[model samples]
Target: MSDTETHARTQAQPRPSDAGATDAGPIQTGTAPEAGRQLPTNDELTVHYPCKYVPVELLAGFGAGCWPCTYEAHSFEEADQLAHPNLCGYGKSLLAYAMQPDVRVLVLTSCCDVMRRVYDVLRDAGAVDFLWLVDLPHLRGPREVARFRGELRRLADAFAAWSGRAFDLDRALASFVPPVPRVDDRVTLLGAHGPLSLVDTCRDELSLPVENGTCTGWRLVQTPPPTLGRAPHEGSCHVCQDGCEAGIPRGDDLDHFLDWYAGALLNQMPCMRMVDSKARAKLVGAPGQHGVIYHTMKFCDYYGFEYLEAAKESKVPMLKIETDGTRQSAGQLRTRLKAFDETLHGMAEAHEVVTRRRGADGGPTYVLGVDSGSTSTDAVIMDGNERIVASVIVATGAKASRGAQNAIGQVLERAGLREGDLTLRVATGYGREAIPDMDSAITEITCHARGAHFLAPDARTVIDIGGQDSKVIHLDEAGGVLNFVMNDKCAAGTGRFLEATARAMELSMEEFCRVGLEWKRDVKISNMCTVFAESEVVSLVADDTPIADIVHGLDMSVASKTAALAKRVKAEPAYLMTGGVAQNVGVVRALEAVLGSSVATHEDSQLCGAIGAALLGLESLN
Candidate 1:
C-alpha cells in the first residue's frame, strides 16, 4: 500500500473497541424489521455502499459492517474543489461522504457516468481505506450472472486481504433473508437514490406512510439458495464432497453459493442503468399506494427518463421533483413536498378544509384570504354570497408576519369590520406559515388554481409570476389543479429578475411597465440568471441602449421562460395571468405574443391568491 493509502487506513478504520460503523440511519426498505431479530456487528470495519445492488451479505461474511452511503452535504465545497463543478448532485453528496475523515470503505457501481468519474477522483485522492467500483453489467442473463459472480468473489478476496480476515461462508449465508412484503397504503418515493434526509422530510410533511422506493432505498435479495445451507446435519451440501461442517461452505460450495447470490443481486428489481430496468415499474402503483414522489438529481439523466415514463403510466398521482443535494434547496423542497401532500390527500380523499366560526345570529359570514408573499401581502374579504367585499395590498418589508398583520387590519377596516367579524382567515404563499392566527395555511398552487377559476370562469390555465418564483398551473374544467410546475429555486424568469433590471436602469417598476410597451427595436437578452441579466442591463445602459427597448427585452425573456413552463404541463388556451406580475402590462403583452394567444388579466390579479384562499375557506363553512 502507498503511504497515502496507509494514512487513510489509520484515519478511517475503527479499532477493536469501537462500535460498528457510524449509523447511516435505516435504509428505508419499505418494511418494518422482524420482531426481536438481531443484526451481526462488525466492530472492526464498516463497508459503505451507495447503491442498492451492493451485496451487503457478502461483506458481512468478511466481518465488515455495511451501510448505505447516503450523506447529504452541508455544501459541495469539497467535491467541487476535487471534481468538476457540474457533477450530478448525488455524486457530489457521495464524494462528501468519501472525503470524510473516518470513511473506511466505499463501494459504488458504474451506475452513471458521473459516478464513474467520482470513482476516478476518489482513487486519485486515496480518500478512503478501501474504494471499489463494481463493474456493473446492464443485462442479467446467465452470462451476466456468471460475470457478476466473479466480480463478487474478487471483491470478497480484496476485502478479506485488506481487513486481514477470512471469509466465513456460513456468516454470509446467515445474513441472507427474504424481503418482507409491504402491503399497506403508502406514498412511494421513486427514481434516483435520494438522501436519507429526503425520506425524513417526507415523513414530516406527509400524513401517509412514507416508503423510500427509490433505486437505493429498496433492496431485495432472495434468501440462501435451497441447495446451499442446511443447519447442522439436516442435509449435506451437494457441492461439498465431504459433508458441510458448521455450515461453512468451502471449495465448490463457496462458488455455488456465490453463483446464487450473484443472480439474486442482479435479477432483483433493476435500476435505471439496467437494460430491463423498465420492468422496475412494478415498484410503483403498488396496491394501496396513495401516490408516488419521484425524485431526480440535477444533471443525472438516468432517472429523469424513467420518471417521465412512470408519470405517463401512473394510475395514482405522481409528483416529480428535482434537487441539487444541497442544504440551500431545503426550503424549496419542503414547500414542494408539502404541497404535493395536500394534492394527494386533499384531492384524493375529498377532505374538507374546515374553517371555524360564523356569526351566531346568521349575519353575513365573512372569510378573509391572506397571501403573505415576499414582495407584498394581499388580503381579500369574501362574504357568504361569494362576493369580495374588501381587499388590501401592503408592501412586505423585513418580516412577513408584520406585513400579513398590516394587510389583514387594513382590509377588515375597509370593510367596516373588526377581526372578530371574520369567520375564517386562510393563509397562502411562501410566507403563509410565518403569519399568525390563520385558520389554515394552504399552498399557493392549490389556491391559485381555485382563484383563477373564480376570477375567470373560462380559464383552464393560470400563469403566476411572483416576486421570488414563477408557476404555471393546469386546471380542470372545475378549476381544480390537475398539475403545476414551479421555478422556485432560482430568481430567473420571475418578478425579481425584472425588478433587478429595472433598478439597474434607475427606473421604478411603474415606469418599467409603460416604457416596455414603447420599444422601437427588439433586443434579445439571452441570459436568464438574475445577476447576469442585471449585468447585461448595465452593459446596455453603458452602450446607451434605449431604456424602453431594454425593458421590453427583459419582459420578453420572462415571457419566453414562462411559456416553456406552460408547455411542460401541457397547458391549453383560456389562460389567466395572476399574481403581481399580471399588473405589468409589458409582461402580459410579451406573454401573449409568445403564447400566440390572448393572456387575459383581471384588475384584482394581485389578489388572486388571497381570493382563492377565501374561496377555499368559504367552502368549509358551506
Candidate 2:
C-alpha cells in the first residue's frame, strides 16, 4: 500500500471516543452513560462485549450500538447468591449487569474461566435477549486469526438477523477508527483491568494523566494496507455491483475486510492470558511513563502473576491495589493512591508557611504535629532545636478531628503556648485531612518513617500497628521512605484486633498486655480475621482455656501477621516498633519471638507519627 492510500484509508475511519472502545469505533463501556448521548431506544439494539476479541465494528455496521461490558453494582449480594461466592468480582458484577433490563444483548469471549461460568449462569437464567460466547484464541497466529474470523462472521449473521439490519460494507469500513496516540507523561495501569470507577479515581484524585494498559483497556489494532479502487458489477455488490459507488468500496470487498479485521483483532497488545506476554514490558516501560498503578481483582490469579512480572520489569514506582469491584473499598484505595501521588510528586512537605512568633526572651519558636488515628489522637510540640517541649495522647472517641483538636489543645496548654505561638501545624494518619487546623497533612507512612528514624537513628525498618491498620516501612538513614507495605482493608494485626480480643476476654487493655508475658503453653489461634479470631477466642474461653495462654495465642497471631508484612517489604533491623501497639509489652515480646531479634521501643513510641509531623512542620519553617 502507498503512503497516500494508507493516509486516505486512515482518514476515512472513525475516531474512537474516550469510552471503552475498540480501535474500529467508539464503544460506550463505562458505568455511566456518555454525556449528551441518550440511552439507546428499544428499536436500537446495543451489543455489549466483555473482552476485546469481539468484533465491535461489525455490530456498529449493523446499525446497533457497541458497548463494552463495564458495570458497577450497588452490592454483590445478588451476584453471590446467583454465582459461586468464589467467583471473580468482575465476573460476578458482569453477571449482575446481565440481569438488568437495559442489557439487550451480551457478547462474552472465552477469555477467563470465570467469565465462561458467568455466561452459563446468565444463559441459564434467561437474563438477556441475545447472548453469544465467542471462543477467543489464546495464541496469535494466522491459523488462530482465520478461526476467529469465522467466529466473527457467525456473530455478524446472528446479530444482523436479530437486529433486522444488514451489515453495510461501507459502514464497517467507515467505523474503523484509528487509536489515539498518547504524547504526555502519564501513569499507566498495568495489570488486570479494573472497573471504570478505579480509572476515574486515578485520573481525578491523583491529578495525573493515566493510561489504561490493563487487559480490558489495552486496545491494539494495526492499520490495514490500502487497496485499489474497486470496479462496478463486482460479485454480491450491494452498493452498485460496483466498480464502486461514491468512490467507496462495495459489499464484494467484505471478505478482504474480514481478513484484515481478523489480523487486527489478533494483533492487539497481548493480554496476561497469553502464553508469552513480553509485549507487556513495552507498555510498562514506555517512555514518559511516570508510575504504574497495578490493579487486581480478588480471587483472580492471572493478573497477580502478571503484576509480579511487570513489577520486576518496570523501573518506575509501582503500587499494587486489589479491589472486589465494589465501592466499599474506595476509602482504602484513595489512601494508597494519595500516598503514591505524594511519593511521585514530593508533596508531603508542609506547603503553607506560618509566621514564627519569637519567644518574649528570644527563645526558640515552637511547632506542633498532630496524628489523628482510628483509636487515639497524639500531639507533639517541638522547639526550633528539635527538642520535644510537650506531648499528649488522647482516646479518639468518635470524631478523629475533635480528638486531634483536643490533643493539640492539651499539648499547647502543657507547653505554656497558645495556637499563635506555634510556627506550623502538620497532621498525619487516617484522619489527617479531617484536621482542618493543620497547616498541611502527610501520609502516616512518611511520618512514621521520619519518627522512627528520629527515635532510633540507626533503625532501617519500622513496624507500626495503629488501631485500624498495620504498616511496615523500610527507611533510609536520612528518614526517607524507601518502601512500605500495609495490611489490606481488613483489621487483622492492628491495635483494633487486640482491643476486640481483649473485650471478648473481658480483660482491661493493661491487663491484656501483661497476661501473655509469661505464657509457655502452646495455644495456637489459627484464624487471623478479626471476627473469626474473636469467635475462636470466645470458644477457647468457654472451654475453660487459661486466660494467659489465650492471650499468648492472640498476641502470637498478631505478631505473625505483622511479621509477614515486615518480611514482604524486606524490613531490616535495627527494627523500631512504633504506634499505640508498641506500648503493649505482650505484642512487642511476641514480635521479637517471630523476628528472632530484639525490637527497639521508645518511651514516646505512641507519639512518633505526631512527632514526625512536628518535625516536618519545623523543617518547613527552615
Candidate 3:
C-alpha cells in the first residue's frame, strides 16, 4: 500500500512516539543539558528553540547544544509588558523566558500568528543576542519543501557566522535515528500546544500513557517509502512531491538530505494550523486510544475551532479544556482531567457489603455526606428512613479539610450523633479529596446529577453554577449521568463572577440579586472577564446608569455564557438549577429567557451535591 494509505490504516494500529522517547525528553529551561546530548561548557553556546519544527540535529552538527525552551514563569508581568495581554499563555510565557539572561540565542518558527508577533516584539526589543524565525509551510508540496530547505540552509549559515562555527556534515548525518513504536493504551492530547507541565499533569492524573499530537507536543521524523521494482514516473512519490526513484534520501547525501528532511517534517500528522488537518483523525482514532483531552488557549481562536471539529468527529469520548497557559489553572485542570478519567474507567464501586453501626438494634442508623467547595463547605446527615436528620453550611475558610471538619461536626452535633454513628461517609466537590475522614469521594458532576434527579424527578438536565466553576449535566431517569461539560478554569459564568460584580457595586449579594430582578432596562455587559467586567460596572455606575439596569446586565452576561455551555452538550428539559448561584432570582430569570424555558430550583439546591453524596452512602450501605 502507498504510505498515505498505510497511514490511513495505521489508525487501527498503535502509533509511534512523535520524536523517539530518548529525543523528546522533558523540556528544560536552565542550562542543564538534556540526557544523551553533549553538555555545553561555559565557553560553548546553546541554541534554544520553542517549537519542534526547528532542526536540532543541524544545530548539533554546528557544535552547538540544542535545548528545548520550556519553562513556567512565576508571573506574566514581564510578558504582558512585552506582548499584548490577550496573547496566548504559552506565547507570553515563552516571551518571559526569552527575556532571561541565560537565553542567549533563540530560534522560533512562524507556526502561528502569536508566535510571529512574539518574534517581532522580541526582535524589535533586542531581547536576545541572536534570533531566527523559520518560515514553515502548511502543506507537503515540492515547492514548499524546497523553500523550507533553503530556509534551513540560511539558518545554518547565519548560526555558523554568529557562533564562529562551521556545520559538520558527518555529525549531522550521524545524528539521524529512527523512532521506536508505541503500543500501550493511551489518551491523545489534541488542539493548541500545551506546556510540559500540563502534559505531565495529564499523564499523571489520567494514569495512562498520553501521546501528544498537538503542535508543541510531537516532532515528526523522516520515514522512507518502500523500494519500487521499476523506476516510477516523475513526481509520483505519494508522500511528497519530490520524485526520486530511490526511497527517502539519507542524511549522508547532502543534496538529497534537505529534500528528505523537508518531506519528513511535512509528511507527519499535520497540526491544526495546517489547511488539511485530517491526519489528526488517525491520532484520535488510533487503536488502544481511550479518550481525548482537547486543550485550547483562552484567547486563541484557532484551536477552539479545531476542538469543535475534533469533538464532533471523534469516536471515543473527549473533554475540552481551556487555559491561559499559566500554572494558576493547574488545580482546575487536574480536577477536570481526573473527572474525565473517572468517567472513562468507571470509579471504583463502593463495597456491596454493609457494616451496621454500633447499637443499631432498635435505634436510628445514619449516613453522612460532605461537600467541600471553594466558597462553602456543606454537610448532610440522613437517617435510615432516607430522611434528612440535619444539614449545615459554612464558609470554607483557607483550608478544605478544616472547613469539612467544621461543617460535618456541626451537622453531626445537630443530629445528636457522633462520627461513629454514621454507617458510611462520602465526600464530593472540588475539595472532596482533601477531606481526610471521608470513606469515598465522587465528582460534583455525578453528585449533582443524582441530587437534581432526586429533587426534581422529571428533570433531564441540571445546570450547576458553583463558586469557581459551572457544569451542565445530562441525566437519565434513574439519576445516572449520561454526559456532562464543565467550565472550571474561568470565573465568567460562576458564583464568583456574581460575587465580584457585587463587590464592585458595593452591594451585598442579596441586594444585588434583588436589584437585578427589578431592572426594567435592557442594558448589556459585553466583557466576560471578571476584572474587566468589574471595571465596566464601575464605569456604568459612575455614568449615573441605574443600579438595577447594571445589575441586570451583569446577570444577563452570566446567563448567556451558561446557556451557551448548556447548548454545547445538547441540554434537555425539564431543567433544574443547582449550586450556590441557583439562589439568584435574576440569573434564573435571565437563564429562562435565554434558554426559552423555565428553570426549577428549590431552597436546598445549594446542598444538592452533599445530598447526593449522602444518598450514595446510603446506597452503598444497603
Candidate 4:
C-alpha cells in the first residue's frame, strides 16, 4: 500500500510551499513576503482577488495584473497564532497569503462578514501597500446597478492615482471575455468558493472530466457593445481583435462604459449573496454533467443547506466533501475522491481491470490482499474458491512499506505459499501506494463495502472507524457502494481517540475496553476535539469520577460522531462495524445504543479491508 498524500497541487496558481517560494520575481508574484519585507517598487503591480466580481480587466486598465487568491494553506501556523481562532479556514488562508511580500495589493469584494473582517485585519496590520474593499449590493436592480457603476468608477480613479497611470477604458473593455459551455461528460464542482487546489484534486482523482462549477467558475460576464470601444467576436477564447475604432471612454462615453461594466458584474450568475439564485441550477444541471462534487468549508453553513437539498433532488451521483481549507485534510481528501471515482465508473471498470490484466486459471490459486493503515498493517490470503486461508496483523511501525513487507511475509508463510504462488495481490488503505509487490490498489472505502457484504450479507451500512479517520459507507443490495460520508479531519471518533484517553488514564487499551462496559452511570463528554477530550478525561479523573464511567463516556462520544456521519448517508439497519476499533466491545455497544440498532463485529473485523481487497482482485480476474 502507498502513503496517502496530496493527489494534486492547487491548479493554476502556484501556492507557496514551506520549502520556498516558486514565484521568483515579477512573472510569479505569489511569493510570501519574508522578515526582510522586500516589497516590489516597480510599476508592474501584482493584484490578488478571491471574488469573481472584481474587475481584473479594470485593474489592467491602469497597470496591475491579477491572481485569484483562493487556495488552501499548507498550515495555519501564522494565521491561527495571530488571527481569530473562530475565523473560517478559507478566511484564515486568505489572510496568510495576503501577508506574503509578493501580494503588494489586493482588491477584495465585500462579499461576506469574513471578507470584511479579512479587510480589517489586513488594514490594521498594513499587510499590503494597496488594500481596497469594493462594496457589492445584494440585489441586481436598476438602482443597484447605478450604485455599483459609481463604485467601479471611484475604484478606477483610486487605482489610477495609486499606480500613477491613466485608466485605459478601451483596454478594460477588451478584457470582457466570455466562457463556452462544455458538452462532454464531466464532474462539476458545486457549492462554496473553493480554491483551485480543490478543482485540481477533482481532476486528478475522477475518471471523467472535471470542472469547477462553483460561484467563481461562473464568471459569465458578457462582452460590452462594440460602440463602447470594445471589439466583437472575442468569443470564449478571449482572442484579441485588431483593426477596431477603439478610443478611451470620455465624458458621456465614460459614463456609458461604467454603466455596462456595473450591469455586467451584477448580471453574471449570482452568488449566494445575491437575491435571484434560480440561475444556480445551471451548476449541477449543466449539459453532459455526469456527477457533482460539492465542497463546503467547515463552519460555513449556507452552501451546506444547498448541498443537502441537491442530494435529495438531483438524479446524478453526488459526493459532498468539507475541509478547513488547509493541507491537513489532504490524505482523507484523496481517499474520498478515489472512492467517488470508483462510484462514478461503477463495477464495470473494476471487473475490466482484473480480466484484462490477469485472472486465475480454472485451478488452485491463492490471491492476497494487504491493508496498510496508519496504525497497523493487515494481510489476508484466499484460495480460488474465495475461502480465507490465512490472515495476519502487525504494527505499522515507522514506515508503511516495512510494515507491509512484514504482514505479507507472515500471511504467505501461514498459508504455506510463496510470492509466485499468489494469482493476484491487491493493496488498500492509507499506505497502499507504499507497499511493494502489489499488482493493484483500491480505496479502503470500496474495499470495506465489499468486505462488509462478505462478512454480513444482511448489512446495508458499514461503519469503519480506523486509526486516523472514520467513514460510513452505504451499499446497494448487490454489495456495491451506493453512497458514503466521512467525518471531519480530526481524531474524535477513531481508534486514536481511545488510545489517547487510555494513555491518559494510565490503562492499557485492553483494560480500558473492559472497564468501559462496567460503567453504571452515563457520563457526558462535552467536546469531541481529541486534545480537549483528553483534558476533560483528566479533569474527570481528578474529580474522583469512576474510571468505568469516564471510559463509557469516551465510547459514547465516538458513537455520537459516528451516528451523525451515518445519518448523512441515510444509513439503514443491519450495520457492520470494521477496522481496528471494532475490537473494542465498549465502542461497539456504545454505537449500538447511539444508532438504536445492533452492530455486528466479526473475529476478522480488522482484516476486513484486506479480505475485501483480495475478494475484489479475484472478482476482477475471474
Best by lDDT: 1
Q: Residues 1-622, candidate 1, lDDT per residue (tens digit)?
A: 2221110000122333453442333222222223442222345467778877777877777666667776789989999999999998888988998887667678888877987999999988877767888888889999999999999888877765555565566766766654444546678888887778888899888888787777777776755655577432324443554464554534444565685789988877778888886677666676778888888888888888887777677777777888887767777778777777766656323324554575566677999999988899999999999999999999999999999999988998999998888888889898998998787888888888788989999999999999989999888898877677889879998888988999999899999999999999999998999999999999999999999999999999999999988976778999999988999999999999999999999999999999988988888776
TM-scores for every predicted model: 0.87, 0.85, 0.81, 0.86
| Candidate 2: regions farther than 4 A off | 1-44, 228-251, 312-314, 347-364, 542-545
Decide which is better by TM-score, 3 or 4.
4
Best first by TM-score, ranked: 1, 4, 2, 3
Which portions of model 1 miss their true places by more than 4 Å? 1-44, 231-253, 281-287, 312-315, 347-355, 358-363, 541-546
C-alpha lDDT score of every prediction, in listed order:
0.79, 0.75, 0.75, 0.79
State residue 3's C-alpha deviation in candidate 3, in Å.
12
Predicted structure 1: lDDT: 0.79
After superposition on all CA atoms, how large is the RMSD of candidate 1?
8.7
lDDT of 2 by residue, 1-622 (tens): 2322211111121222222222333323322332443444434556777676677766666655666665677888889888898988888889788877767678988888987899899877777777889888888888988998998888876765554455555656556666565645678776775567888888866756887666676555565545512322234434543244554544344465676788777777777777777766666666677888888888898888876776656677778888777788786677777667765665344234454544455656788899988889999999989999999999988998788888988998999988877777888888888988667777777677778888989999999988988888877677777667778588898888999999999999999998888786979999999899999999999999999999999988999999987765667888899988999988998899999999989998899999888887777667
Cα-based lDDT at residue 120, candidate 1: 99
lDDT of 3 by residue, 157-245 (tens): 67655555545545555455455466456788877767778888998877677777666666655543333112233344434434534
The clash count of every prediction, one per candidate, is: 0, 6, 0, 12
> What is residue 441's positional error in candidate 3, in angstroms?
3.5
| TM-score, model 3 to reference | 0.81
Worst 10 residues of 4 by lDDT: 1-10
Better of 1 and 3 by TM-score: 1
Worst 10 residues of 1 by lDDT: 3-12
lDDT of 4 by residue, 1-622 (tens): 0122111111232222211121222332233443555554444456788887887767755545567887778877887766788998788999889877677788899888899999998987878877889999999999998898888888877765555555566656655554443536777787787787887888888888787767555465666777667422222222333332344222443455676778977777778878787767656655567788998888788788888877877877789988787877777788889888887777436422344333344557778999999899999999878899999999999999999999999999999988877888889998998987688889888888888889999889999998988999998887788889876477888999889999999999999989999999999999888888889999999999999999999999999999999987889988999988999999999999999999999998889899989988888866
